[model samples]
Target: MHDLEASLLGGDRDLTLRDLADRAGPGVRPEDVQLFWRTLGLPYADTDERLFTDDDAQAVARIADLERSGRIDRRTAVTLTRALGHQSERLVLWQVEALVEDVAQRRHLDDISARLVVLDRLTELAPVLEAQLVHSFRRHLAAIAGRFAAEFAEARTTEQADPSALPLARAVGFADMVSFTRRTAGLGSTDLSAFVQRFETAARDIVANAGGRVVKTIGDAVLFIADDVVTGARVAVGLAGELGGELEVQARSEEGGLTEGHRGVTPVRVGFVQGRVLSRFGDVFGASVNVAARLTDIAEPSTVLTDPSTAELLAGDSRFVLEPQPPRELQGLGSIAPVLVRQA
Candidate 1:
């Protein structure tokens, strides 16, 4: 088990904190290394502990060089480092848990035995998994770059980007599974896993087909975003058309859209709004996100609702039909007339 550490970390963990700091670079300090580790959600090592490796030293040196060369400031550096810390931890855990489940099932072992087996197998699997992680990360980076080039190519070079304004002109919303607790109340582990996995799988396909990106899926809900309103409208209506029913066209009319589903088919209510959103910590924030969530909560099962402004944007598009629902007072957002979106 101790030897596995060197294999996974790319070298022996032979350097103390002070030794690693001096070895990192001329500008690197012990505190800088501490900051990086701390931001990565790790506990501090004792001053004399040899828990770090050359790979760790290189990472610190790289960050310090970026700061020294004015390529990145401390705050930005912290943000980037923290992002890696946050996502990397989740990614590794997700993979490891999947492996644990697989091992338990395949070996006919209990969960505890499976976990022990996984610990023994991890050193063998680490390199392959690490390669895939790097490859997938690079592909995502390219995808983002393509979005920027295609979306911002016509913008004036002299125009200053508003740092305070919600950065992306996005369509953000949540699609929550209707009657989630009631539906899953009696399911066993395998059944629940299948249910949730089915929703996420289908939701991902729906979002991708509509040219939207799924931000993340909560246990019983999915958060999605699109570059513009039309695509967003497509995503919302698509979600409804595929796995939902129609809601009232007017304000709370008839309380419709809720319908029965066959086994394996889950109902969802979607709501999205077109507005600027603050993208941070790998998720979105701001009023638009809140409003969208509010609209979703108010929405009948299988319905897709949008705020009045988003409705107006989609109103001009021939692909969708927007019905003006009367104004409803939404919590935190005051009075907003929700619009029901339908495919033409």
Candidate 2:
């Protein structure tokens, strides 16, 4: 048992399921050891005898401690473990894809050979990369664990509510092109690619120039969550105007003809709203994102639709003309009254 305990406590290389069963004593069968791991939601399939890492053993010990302390019900613990496993799988897959793409692009290698090289290089660099990734992953996990631990303790202490609630902040919004998929559908792959690139470049510059951070781009949409109403409003209006103007120019250049709404090109619709948001994992969530996206869907090409709250924020701004549209029913949000804004 002492030997088993020492081996299990040491690190990745020395730990094994055999050590665990030995420490668990004579009556604890190999199946029992394997079942214990399964309870923690690890994706590992355990034979009657299968090896385990020290990290696995340590995690199991922590879960056991929680059970002994009555901190979590067994069912809830199982659910949490499963959720963590799913998230880990997603993060791993995203990172792997990112790394593969990065290596391929950097080396300018063709597909088949690039994949082979990626695997070969990964094998050679596994030790160093693993150590670094483990360190970072553990730190992030510890932070999340600490937050949950604090929340659990608060929940236990308070009858009505927990004091360790998530922090709140000011407004957020997203800007997206309307009918972008439909509009680009008629375009060939090369033209479609150019159009998308132009949209991103214009949106990014306008957002940054207007004092907002481009959180990320999702297809035809760009999510920009600002710390305050002013910043969010600025970003939305700037993006709409700049992208609209650029599209007009690009359209004229392409067709070599001038007409109404074709002074230069077609334009994109943008939407903005101001509300609390949940920022997580390089993404923003909450009603702000939803409303902004939905509004964009309904907006006319080359227009900006803003919620009442956002309109009020820009009430006195001269750079835009905000014209109120009648109250309309929207999915999920029911009835909403918004205003269209355009550069005067």
Candidate 3:
């Protein structure tokens, strides 16, 4: 086996496309295997080359078994395959790049050599990564299951007892770095990466500690959501006040340490809204998301803004103070008043 194939397939390059299909047992057609392969985001060719592995064959066989047992229909099977493919493609690339960057920095190697080292390291780390992935998937699945169970119980006890009408209420928010483009315009790759990493790490820590989950991070902004308004409020306030203040202080302390033309501090503006959101594909959407993002666009550095609805929800809470802002016309969203929030 060639080095690349051996490294990737773990020396399992004995089976061809035809052989793999046969090994998947009866009722599993070559076309079915092709479909599975394509659904996994892999390009397929009609050659009899020994390019497939035992693991690949077994995986296809398991899918066939699932279909035969009626555990999943063909459409569902394809969806599951696509989801795994889509997510894993990005996951593997991110992990590999991270490893390559570490190797390059630590050993002072060129990009080519760094990639070669990363490929070698991956062969050794693959099993560990796989195990960790499985472990984390189970833990996350358990959390989702527990949440659904509790929500279903509550729904059953409610007067309506109708799941369709009462969608899940959540607090969605955005925290955006101020003047990100101008701040990083002169930074080299290394410095830019460091700056982004610092912001992302700090933002994630603050959001997680405040009982909110980060949905995603754009280049200069983070989107987060919480099951309750109070938790979201805490996250917003923490990011704008505590975390933002700390970064500012650090920037001042390290001002002399920075390279010329590089900014030391990352200031962020945050906005939050509490309302029902349409959750799909591990992302949240709808007007609440739009409003929160719009509010973030208008918020000043180290400050949090919320819509009237969120302010009302948080009004009775002594931990926060809300001051109403003048009605401002937002693009796409009509004229609306927002409230500034601060820790009491």
Candidate 4:
């Protein structure tokens, strides 16, 4: 076990948990170190157990420095640590599993052998993946900074706003693939992967071109946001129309297997609403977000639906023809009428 630990960590194997804490220097509280460990999703180790390395001590020291400098409070530190832990854990699992599956299929190997292949490849892949993550994060951070700058400049021109109020009033929406489970039933890995990739890529392109941002893509749906209602409406309408067109084109194409006769194509339904939303961790949440999701569930394929409030706001738009749908009972939301939006 000690030899394995030495080989894996590539460091002295005699440092206990308490020894690591002591190496972090003074003014780093015991509780703070424990909290950091727990936030990183690590189980508690006995204080006397040699389970940590010098790198771990350095990380704790860096976190302590950040906290001491007032750059991050205790709560924020925990949140940051937890986010890193949770997101990285999921990402690492996903990447490793994808690699294992590919190796298993290509080499006709058993599961254990495939995993061994993954382990062999990980050392070569880790640094590349880390660099890519950092590069992507920097680019994303730049975009976020630019957005905030533009938004703050706009806010300065507004009248009598509370300084502490959240800065953005955005439109949030959801677009869900209809009959997803039924459509993808009995599909092999390659076919299913292509289908989902096609949908997500198309959805993202549609949203971006319509001046909206895709917040995230779920298996059979996407969540998006835009700076204003008009942009949001355009995104919702474009997603449905464009996806529908893709399906039609696929149905007409003479490709084989799943691509034949729209066997791989899926129709999408969209719902959008304009309101103030709370943005946290690159995701939006609020009543409007819930309403948008609910509306998408009730929308028909290749169509867009909006709440009455949103419809009222968009009443006079010439590009859209709005039709009133009968009010129906919705779970959790109770009875409500939704407006069907058609592109003119």
Candidate 5:
């Protein structure tokens, strides 16, 4: 009773931590209350400092109750805070217009007009969007971490993979839109928006359907990697074909005015190479990856090209027809002859 009294009337009614404990009821302990604030990364004060307002106290008390009920822990609470902070930093840095546009669509507003409104009301009207973005960022980070842990753990536990794990051979590939800069420049804002969206959609669908994992999407291209050479070959072929078809469709559409007579919507040139790659930070590296990207750069529009190794691996695959092109003096890479693929 004395402690409760000390808390309630304590510190000249400044609504400090002690006062918060007093309002939390007789059953709630002050230690747990303090821990709750600490978990929230709020400063702990011993003096008669008004660190927590009534609302803050109530929130802490509720969180404490949730903790006691096995809903969360001090560590988890801290992680949530850190994760939220990191996500906020990224959102502020990127100014991702897609996020704002998504909210606009949900609210039945025109995306373009809503973009301006979203910019103006970001701090107020889009709390839900912000929260969702935070949640997504956390989930992605966790997933990536989990995958890394699993891979490393497997490497350590299995004699076949060693503590450090020998790098495994994989087929790496890249598909990039040719003349993307020129095409985008020729487009209006609305057309440019649709063009980028259609390209991404097509790329993702093609990559996944061909049993390849999309590593990342640069502005006008996507990178993919597959475990086997055959899968990589199929991925390249499928991606090129899909891009060609989509480009044709897009060219006929009004938004595709930039591609009306240019054969296709900046046809994606794909290239693949089979070799060892280092997977880290949700990305791949090594010479093979580099070569694949360079190959994509040199490939003709709407075509799939592959290094000699990848072509050799898929030589027996009757579903594909491969034809070699003349040796080109690729920069950074010595003389090389790449094979182009066609449907059989």
Candidate 6:
């Protein structure tokens, strides 16, 4: 066995499934152990195969301790395990791919060669990357805790809010990139990667600077949320004006014309709303989210739009002008007047 693999596993893979269950202490069923493996996005293991290690046993034991102590429920434990598995899977893939791309770029290697080089260097890089991941996890956790505190420090009881409606009253928005498919129809891998990374980086930066949280970046759009409508308005306007306008000017510039890279792919249409939304599984949902998306579809390039209800809320704010547009029928959302929002 490789030394680095052994170091990571805490020993050779000498333990069988049965051995793992036995070492996990009392009340740790073998089936539950299998469930744990499955929840970690691994396949079910044979009972007699020596495919397990001390690290596996230790993880099951620790979770067993928590369960026995009543600190965590079995269902939630599984969910939490799945969360770690899912997120870590994506995170590592993204991190590794970025490393491969960087290495390929620097050394002028092809895809397979870059991958081989990356595989050889990963064990050495793993420790450093793991430390950074821990640091980032801690920082993000602290930020979430801080947000929770600020949100609930002076909150009203649940019953005081509309019982039938979604619990959280948030500002939801979407910024849809105009004609994304048309813009990059035949781009190669490097160009495509750069295009996506650039958009995501810019969108995330805009959301953060505008007091909004990016829910996620869809392939052709980004979803953002803010604590209040005004903040969401700022987010919406920034995506439309700052990001989209930047692209529009690029499309017309000497270096950014269609003959160059797809710098001509310009402008994003933004839409936002102030309403109750159900926040779950790292995304938001509700009428507001739906309306925001629908409005984005109808918005012109480099423009921001909102429902009348949301616009009315921002109407009193001096930072924006609410231009009322005629009612338009949105698929599954009925005919609704879209109001354009722009900075004063």
Candidate number of the best lDDT: 6
Higher-TM-score candidate among 1 and 6? 6
lDDT of 5 by residue, 1-344 (tens): 34433343232335767777777666666665676665544467873576555666666566556656779876776566554445455556456576565666577676677767765665453556657877987997897687567667776776663436338667889999877887666555545666888788888888878877898889888999886788888889888877866353223344433444443445689989998888764578888988998899898888988877778877888988989899987779888998888778
Number of the top-ranking candidate, with TM-score as the measure: 6
Query: Per-residue lDDT of 1-344 in model 4, one digit per residue for the tens?
Result: 45544544656656766776777777775666778889998876777877677777888888877888999998898888988888878877877778887998799887899999888777677778879989988998898899899988887798855656554689999999988888777666655665776788889999999999999898999999999888899999999988875442232222333445443456799999998788887578888899999999899999999989999988888988899999977679999999998888
Deviation from native of the Cα of residue 126 in model 1, angstroms:
1.2
Against the true structure, candidate 4 reaches a TM-score of 0.84
Alpha carbon lDDT of residue 68, candidate 4? 81
lDDT of 6 at 283: 79
lDDT values for all models:
0.83, 0.66, 0.83, 0.82, 0.72, 0.85
lDDT for each residue of candidate 1 in 241-284, tens digit (9 for 90 to 100): 67664222111113332234345446799899999988888899
Ranking under TM-score, best-scoring first?
6, 1, 3, 4, 5, 2
TM-scores of all candidate predictions against the true structure: 0.89, 0.56, 0.87, 0.84, 0.59, 0.91
Winner on TM-score between 3 and 6 is: 6
Which residue pairs overlap in candidate 2's backbone?
Answer: 247-265, 248-264, 248-265, 252-264
Candidate 2 regions exceeding 4 Å error are: 1-42, 47-51, 59-91, 102-108, 123-170, 178-218, 241-268, 276-290, 316-321, 326-329, 332-335, 342-344
Give the residue spans of candidate 5 off by over 4 A.
1-96, 102-166, 246-264
Q: What tens-digit string does per-residue lDDT give for candidate 6 at 47-153?
A: 88888898899998888788889999999889888888888888989999999999998998989999999988877898899899999999999998998888786
lDDT of 3 at 61: 83
True-vs-predicted CA distance for residue 154, candidate 4, Å = 0.7
